[model samples]
Target: MREAFHEQLDGVFDDLAGICRSVETAVRLATQALLSGDAAIAEQVISADADIDKAKEKIEDTCFQLLSLQQPVAGDLRVVVSALRMVTELERMGDLSVHVAKIARLRVPDIAVPEEVRPTLARMGEVAEDMVCRVEQIITTKDVEAAIELGRADEIMDGLRRQSFAELFADEWAHGVEAAVDIALLGRYYERIADHAVSVANRVVYVVTGDFPVDV
Candidate 1:
């Protein structure tokens, strides 16, 4: 029975990892579409978000089933509880990516990102992707230290967001108010994605160590 329970637990981990990968793809594609004005890629991201939602539902269902049937205790119970909350964060992260893509689609071929802030936005996306990838690793490996380090990665994302806003509000800014608003929202989406990634990593730490980091 314990073996079967462990198997179900492993399955839960797989589902979480799947959600992470889906979110990563969504964010990356959304960033690309926003930068390059690829409406097709934006459409793909908008459509793919449903799959991420479905993935979240799957994990939620599995976690509940495990709790009802197996009645996991101690560390095992913590794992299941953490999985339930972690999927919520992952789903929100997925939604943020969808928002990014929708902004791209709404603007169509004109591109939502201004030329001056492209590099900053690109770097922000890269950092988010890296942190999300770490989310997958933390799920699989249960490395508490990796989860802790993800906070540092989120700091990088926060810095990029500030930089993006500075560019938007620069004295010589020529993109105009509409573009500035668009990029500002885009920066927020990226920053929120990173925040969610950190949240997911903290869930992992909670599952392993049974104590969430104070900052999270």
Candidate 2:
């Protein structure tokens, strides 16, 4: 019975990891669509959201099955519960990507993102992607220390968000209000993506160390 329970738990982890990868891909594609003014790619990201939703549902169902059948105890219970919470965060991350894609579609002929902000957005995307990847590593390795470090990386994203906002709100770009709003929204989305990644890392920390990260 114990071995069977462990097998089910492993399956749950695999599902969660798959969801995370899908979300990460969506985010990357959305960022590219924004930068390139690719209406088609933006539409693709918007349409692909349903796929992420379905993956989340499957993960949730698997988690429920694990809990119902295994009745996990102590650390095992933590792993099961954390898987559910992690998938919730991953789903939100996927939604944020869709939000960015919507903005890309709205901009249409006149790209919503200004050239000045492109570099910052690219950097933000890189950091957000790295966070998602690292969270997956933490989940697979059960590395509490690595999870904590991933959480700390959120600070870099926060700083970038603030800088981006400052530039957007500055007097020089006053004429581009609509574009500025889009850029600001995009920055917030990327920052929140990192935030959610940190949340997943926290869950991994709890699952492995049996304690929630101190600063979550």
Candidate 3:
């Protein structure tokens, strides 16, 4: 009976890991679609969102089943309960990626980013993507140290977000309001990806230590 329960727990872990990887890919591919104005890629990201949702649902259902059947205690309970919450954040991250891709598709053949802001957007995407990857590692390895450090990592994304906003709101800004809105929304999407990644790390800390990090 104990072995069967552990197997079920292991299945939940595997499913959660798959979610982390999928959202990471979504963010990266959305960035590509944004930069290149590739409708095809953007469409692909939009469609791939279904898979992320399905993964989250599977984890949530498994968590509910475990909580009901196995009645996990202490660390096991933490793992099951935290997973139910973490998948919400992960799903939102996936949605943010879809938001980014929708902008690319909205503009169709035209690149969503203005030339002056391309480098900043690129940096935002890279940092946000890396944050997700790091969060995944923290979740799998239960690295409390990395989870604590995750907040510091978010600073890079915040900085880039500020830079993007500055360009859009600058007096010399030539892009019209329509373009300005796109830049603003796109920057926010990247920033939010990092934010969710940090949230994931926070939940990971809770799972491992039974306490949320004060800073992360």
Candidate 4:
């Protein structure tokens, strides 16, 4: 019975990892489409988001089934709880990517995004992507160190979000309002994505160490 339980737990972990990977791909593709002003790519990202949502539902169902069938204790309980939380975070990340794609499609005529802000936006996306990747690693390895590193990446996303706001409001106040709003929302979405990734990392820490990491 123990052996069968372990096998089922492994299956749950695999489903969670698969969901995370789908979210990471969706975000990366959405960022690329937005940067390159590719409407077709944006449409594809939007379409792919549905798959992510379905994946989330499947993962959540699996977690619940595990909880019902196997009376997990200590670390095992943490794994099941974390799987549920991770699915929620991954789903939110997918929705954010879809939001970015929507913006990209709306701003199709103006292909050239502001040169100054482009770098910052790119960096934000990179950090978010890195955080997602780290969460995947943390889940697989149960590494508290890597989970802590996710916090650092999240700080970078926060800094970029503030920087984007400052630049948007500094000059170009009249003509740049709409563009600024779009950029601001994009930055916010990226920041939130990082936050959710960090949450997943924290869950991993809990699973490994059996204690919640202090949120700093």
**Could you tell me every candidate's TM-score relative to the true structure?**
0.96, 0.95, 0.95, 0.93
Pairs of colliding residues, candidate 3: none
Regarding lDDT, does 3 or 4 come out ahead? 3
By the lDDT metric, which is better: model 1 or model 3?
1
**Candidate 2: 10-residue stretch with minimal lDDT:** 169-178
Which residue pairs in model 2 clash with each other?
none
**Pairs of residues clashing in candidate 1:** none
lDDT digits (tens) for residues 1-216 of candidate 1: 889999999999988998999988988998899889999999999999889889888898889999999998989988888888889999999899999989999998698887889999999889988889999999989999999999999888888888988897779899899999998898899999998999889888888788999966
Q: Which of candidates 2 and 4 reaches a greater TM-score? A: 2
lDDT of 3 by residue, 38-119 (tens): 9999999999999999988888888898989889898888888888888999999999999999999999778888899999
Model 1, runs deviating above 4 Å = none
**Per lDDT, what order, best first?**
1, 3, 2, 4
Return the top candidate by TM-score. Answer: 1
- Point out the higher-scoring one by TM-score: 3 or 4: 3
Clash count, one per candidate: 0, 0, 0, 0
Over the stretch 36-88, how does candidate 4's per-residue lDDT look in tens digits? 88999889989998888888888788778778887778777777887788788
Cα misplacement distance, residue 99 of candidate 2 (Å): 0.3
In terms of lDDT, model 2 sits at: 0.86
Error of 1 at 120 (Å): 0.7
Candidate 3 wrongly placed segments (more than 4 Å)? none
At residue 164, give the lDDT of candidate 4. Answer: 83
